[model samples]
Target: MTEPLIELKGVSKSFGSHKVLDNVDLTIYRGEALGIIGPSGTGKSTILRIMAGLLAPDEGEIYVQGVRRDGLIEDGGDPVGIGMVFQQAALFDSLTVEENVGFLLYQNSKLPRSRIRELVKEKLEMVGLPGITNLYPAELSGGMRKRVSFARAIMSNPDNPSETPEVLLYDEPTAGLDPIASTVIEDLIRYLQSAQGVCGTYAVVTHQDSTIRRTSDRLVFLYEGKVQWQGTVSEIDSTEHPLIRQFISGNVHGPIQVAG
Candidate 1:
């Protein structure tokens, strides 16, 4: 976890005139579960997008495995594979679970349908989801859909091992789930960080307290387009940092201005 895998140096971005990230410097070290948390409009997700190379920073530089990325992912591949799990699961509504999980292999690889199906099944089972491959996204519950997305994010062609993602970026992974469901997702996040799991390094942007506390070894609190505070999960409770204190306690009378 001491080695840096991805780094954002003086990164800033804006949509129109509204600034999101302002010269924010952040890093994700290898084999670390890093959580990014803040209020709704704080650009946490934006940071994840930039990390995934889905969006180019308006200012500043992004490095993957110490090499500066020149453009968006479409321009060139990073030194290591990076995968993303979107907030909505982002599965094709018409596609079955099998299709959704194996979509990448199906589109980009010459692997046989049987091979892809086998790989899909293996991933599904890895996420504790089995025998639901024939079902559509609509047929699954919120948590089930999330697990399916997890399977998809970790999917890689056995023929091309380098294509496997070394880092995963998760955006609001447990947003709409109930308490129990949220716990399930949180558990899965930690599980995937284990040696038996596919991805050991990941950055999660989440608002759920349990998800943040359970999945993250270290956390960075984003507010007003900058990283205001950062520390280990255990340090959260002991710190008197106003922003983090206010956020954790859900106090409306703190420095955070609540939007109407």
Candidate 2:
């Protein structure tokens, strides 16, 4: 088998005294879409943060392609070449859509202003948000803001021309929109995954069944700070695991306890 594009081995993290991730081991292959689904507060988003270098695991190592990344950001390890679309569409309210999309380009790359604007336009159009570049995040609908954030995340290539990023991390890509808007975002997710080709190796953190079914080539179930089940999309519907079954059926009983 080919070496995994990204690998996490025995990774664990905690906040205060509560363990959020426990000895988690996962590998994302090049050009594959991996979906992560679980109940709320199962550390789904934390996992994405760790992968993006926003958070460091207390144990284990993170390998991007073949290099080990740990505490190297201070010494300039290139910030992991990863893009994160935050759950809340964390766009800058003060900036126009064009500015928000080109924020990174302006900050990191030496590309001229005119060139950045061109790239911003291209990315916005790619996400089906053309002609809204002048709008601010507050001026747009929830779904459009998400798309603008999406455009920002992928604004620049993740890797060197020869070794581009093999993984794209998405956190709750369809969380707040209405059903129809959510579907539109879902389709856009699919489209960008295919169109960019850089995101072949990717992961999404979500609980929406339709998002899981439509976006995941493989699914990993996170529970109680660990992965309880892992399988393809088809397996999700037939799996007999109690947690998986309860989650899919939206039941309040079984092994999953809801805190009051």
Candidate 3:
């Protein structure tokens, strides 16, 4: 069997008196989109943060492409190389859209400024915002800004030619957007998976059913600080697991309780 691109073995996390994750194990494979879904505050985004090397697990181990992730970078660097799209669509407000998209190449690469500008325009067009490269973050709408963030996240790492950051993580990519905007982001996510010359595995954290259904082929339903269940998208709708049923049905009461 082909080895997984990333794996978490008996991973656990806690903060003060609260235990957020407990012995959770998971795997992500190449060229696949994995969705993480659960009630609020169940540690969905925490998994992404840990995997991206931004946070460390209190116990257990993480592995990327067979190499272990010992903990947070001792030198404050990303050893595994990952791309992240934060929930708020983190972007530099002072930079133009072109600069934001091509920041990595410009800052770290020996490429000429003219070539970087062309690459920046290409990425912007990939996200369906072709002509807005000269604009600043504050000038774009929330969804457009989010798209720009995506362009930045997926840009090639010019510092290391062989290290393209084969993993991408998204934390609530569609949050706070209207339905139409959400759909646009959803299409972008799909396009990225099959976009020519783009390659990687991705994990997405979301509470939106549409996002889960449209973006993920397989999904893990997290509850009580564990991967309670996992299956294909078709199975998610058909499964009778109590919490999964309650969540997919949007029921007020089930095995899961909402935090008051």
Task: Using TM-score, give the best candidate's number.
Answer: 1
Clash pairs detected, candidate 2 = 31-200, 31-201, 32-200
**Candidate achieving the largest lDDT:** 1
**Structural similarity to truth (TM-score) of each candidate:** 0.98, 0.94, 0.94
Report how far off residue 213 is in candidate 1 (Å): 1.0
TM-score of 2: 0.94
Cα lDDT, all candidates: 0.94, 0.83, 0.87
- Model 3, global lDDT: 0.87
Order candidates by lDDT, high to low.
Answer: 1, 3, 2
- Give the alpha carbon lDDT tens digit for every residue of 1-260 in model 1: 48899999999999999999999999999999999999999999999999998999999999999999999999998988999999999999999999999999999999999999999999999899999999999999999999999999999988998889999999999999999999999998888888464879999999888988899999999999999999999998999999999999999999999998
In model 2, where do residues sit more than 4 Å from their true spots?
72-75, 78-80, 157-165, 196-198
- On residues 119-199, what C-alpha lDDT tens digit does candidate 3 reach at each position? 888888889899998999999999999999988888875546454667789899999999999999998998887887665
Please tell me which model should have the higher TM-score, number 1 or number 3: 1
Q: How big is the positional error of residue 193 in model 3, measured in Å on the Cα after superposition?
A: 0.6
Question: Once model 3 is optimally superposed onto the true structure by TM-score, how far is the C-alpha of residue 94 displaced, in angstroms?
Answer: 1.7
Taking all chains together, the TM-score of candidate 3 against the true structure is: 0.94
